[model samples]
Target: MAFLTNVNPALAAYLNEADPTLWSRVYCPGDRYNIKTSNIAESINSMLMKAKGYTITYLIEFITKKLGRWYWKRREDALSLITTFSRGVEFLLALREHYADMMTVERIDGWRFYARGGQRDCLVDLEAKSCSCGVFDVEKMPCSHAIKAVKSSGWHMSTVVEAYYRKDYVYASYAATIIPNVEHDPIGPNIRCIPPIPKQKPGRQKKYRWLTWLELSRKNGSKPRKSHKQYMLVQNADSLDILNLIV
Candidate 1:
């Protein structure tokens, strides 16, 4: 109950319950620390550097002309693949769904972090919001530990995606195409064809044939049944063993 009170007051009040361990962890910070910073310019710049390597001019011109359509049409049918690939650092930091194991949510002086008794592998999620791990702001994406937090929250990934991707930026290319339809209407009615409807298949023959059981029997023999036989035999004792026993 105490943990709920600190982690999310609304949840505590709504559920009418408190978590002692959470409260204890929140208040106790003898071991554990928070990470600092929120900008990931370096990381983004790295991505930009790699992406810029592609020769833009050499690629198809349509991409620059109709970016939205190009992106939309090219989006893979594999939704799962895209969702996983698109998960950036932010989602991980905010959610912290990755490291659900060792870290516990601890808040000291209103700052939150998933702290371990010592500090190796521990993470903090802070926008000065809540996190002991400070990787969120530094990289502008979820740190590995932050991804653990997100998974713990039970929130939809789609919501995270919407928050990260800007609306105008994602929609701009699709909205630009405005080519109007300008084809002429109908002209005149045409006559139908009547060339015996083209031969669809060979016609069924009317040749006479026998279908009686005897006729079938004469044509083909019935499957034969196997003979039922069983044999049991008892072997005599080996000569060497019997001779030794007798001696």
Candidate 2:
């Protein structure tokens, strides 16, 4: 944030006005491990840019087919996996282990310890799964300090990592098959059928709502949108659709 303020005051001011937790993934609450940016969303939007021109039924069918293929592929991949943690989390754990090699741990008790790494010292509590650096609490993954403490206590690295990173949990996540939408299913006669609205210009249509300052400025629509409605739509659709599309 300080760097941003030095580079561009306008961008920095906008960032400061927004909730810090929303922008900085490190300080974000909950088990939001390995989720930093919306690159996954951007990738999907880029993939489906051409589908935006298709009619509603065609769009639905296209997406449905894509999803079915992905679900089958991922399910097979997950079933074949032999590793404990998922690939991404495993990489993080390995990286933290490397950092832990340089750190020193002093046990204060069975659950708590003091670890010194890089130029700083932090208190680590294995039972609570936390470190004074705040990374362990927020990311639900062991930092260097926590890793040192875990090693000193003769605990496995997996003992400190969150359950969400477990192979069973990851496999269970992608286990379900996606049934494709029924083809040529006619709409009911009593129900009114509405076609999707057309885009006036050529460009990739965004599936997610714009929240950042630059994105707000790039918005092309003239009419004012209700912020609450837009936010709700983004939360609901983005969460469901993107998970199916990318995962």
Candidate 3:
């Protein structure tokens, strides 16, 4: 904050106004389950980069086939998992356990302890499932400090981790199949469909879509507007009228 104030006081002030929980993992009230990135949509867009020039029908078919393959492969992997936790979580816990072995735990109480090791010291609370280092609180998994504390308290590592990291939960996540639609003949007589005429705007074409006001507000570090459900209902009504006219 001192560095921010020195460089850009206005930006620092803006950040101070915003809720830290929304951006800072340390302050987050809920578990992230160790999923760090929030740009899954951008990742999907990157995956579809090659299909950008394809027709809408072909593009959809490509996406469906890709998703179907992913679902099948992931379901097989999930089913093959013999461990209680998912493979990734199991690996993570193992790494943490290795570091935890070096840590010395001092019992503060039945459910609390102070862990000191490798130039780092942290307070661990087994009852609250948290540590001063914040990893256990946000990820819902035992950090090295918490792991040391757990071992000292005669508790299993599995008991410290959240159920979300369990193999069963991971399997359930990929259980849904993405079946592609079968090709079918049109119900009505065949008719030639012409493409709509394109009107070129009097400027350089935009490479990206314009951000919505909500998105803009978030990007600009401003307060977001409340959602307009009534406005959305009116828009839906208008769309229904258009569909009725087409019918």
Candidate 4:
């Protein structure tokens, strides 16, 4: 924030005015599950890249087929899981458990414990499923401190982990089937359907599509180059002046 204020005070002020919960995971009320990007949307776009020019009906059909295949494959994978939690969660828990083995847990009460490991000491509450490190509370999964406390108290790891990471939940998520509608013969008199004619705008149409930030960065071999308009803007201009120039 300090760096942003120094570089662009207007951008910093705008960000400060907005609710941090909308942008910062630290302030978010709901669980983020460690995800911090729009990779899901990017993945969908990648899948439909070749189908960009397809007509509406064909595009829908293509997407349905693709999703159906994904559902079937994922359902099969979920069925094969013998563990209580998903593979990813199980792997993470196992890794944390290894670290927890090195940590020493001192019972503060029936549910609370003080875990000391390496240079850090953390408070772990088994009943609340939280750790002073903040990882357990945010991830909804036991951190190393919590794991040590759980083991010392002879409590099950499953009791501390959220149900969202369970095999049953994963299986249920992919249980639905995507079925396309079957073609039906028209009973009424056939009427010719035609698309409306497109009216040309006053200006000439663009010859090329605009490149995305990722494309631009890749083309430059690092950061994206500033546009001609951006270069024209005065470097030391105030926020109001910058806005007026942009307008």
Give a tens-digit lDDT track for model 3, residues 1-247: 8999999999999989999878767777765444647588888999998666655666677688799999899889988988999888889999999999998999998889999995579999999998988788878899999998988888888898998889888879989888776775322212323478999999988798889989999999988886655533436777889877977
Note the Cα lDDT for every prediction shown: 0.45, 0.78, 0.83, 0.85
Better of 1 and 2 by lDDT: 2
Clashing pairs in 3: none
User: RMSD to the native, candidate 2?
Assistant: 22.3
Model 3 Cα shift for residue 226 (angstroms): 53
* Clashing pairs in model 4, backbone N/Cα/C closer than 3 A: none
Which one wins on TM-score?
4
Candidate 2 per-residue C-alpha lDDT over 44-102 given as tens digits, one digit per residue, 9 for 90 to 100: 78877766765566667667778888878877877777888888787888898898999
Clashing pairs in 2: none
lDDT of 1: 0.45
Worst 10 residues of 2 by lDDT: 223-232
Using lDDT as the measure, the top candidate is: 4
Q: List model 1 lDDT by residue over 1-247, tens digit each.
A: 6986999989778655555434443343342224323456565455445334344432223233344445555343223333333433335434444445545544432323455542455555443323345444433445445444454555444333324343343344344454322353322123222245565567985688766765566567863244448753436668657766867
The predicted structure with the larger lDDT, 1 or 4, is 4
Superposed model 3: Cα runs more than 4 Å off: 1-14, 32-39, 183-194, 197-247
Clashes of each: 39, 0, 0, 0
Query: 1-247 in candidate 4: lDDT tens per residue?
Result: 9999999999999999999989867678997656646998899999998666645566676688799999999999999999999999999999999999998989989999999995589999988888888888889999989999999999898899999899999989999999864584322223323467999898988798899887989987996665544445456659658779779
Worst 10 residues of 1 by lDDT: 185-194
Deviation from truth (RMSD, Å), model 1: 24.2
Residue-level lDDT for 136 in candidate 1: 45
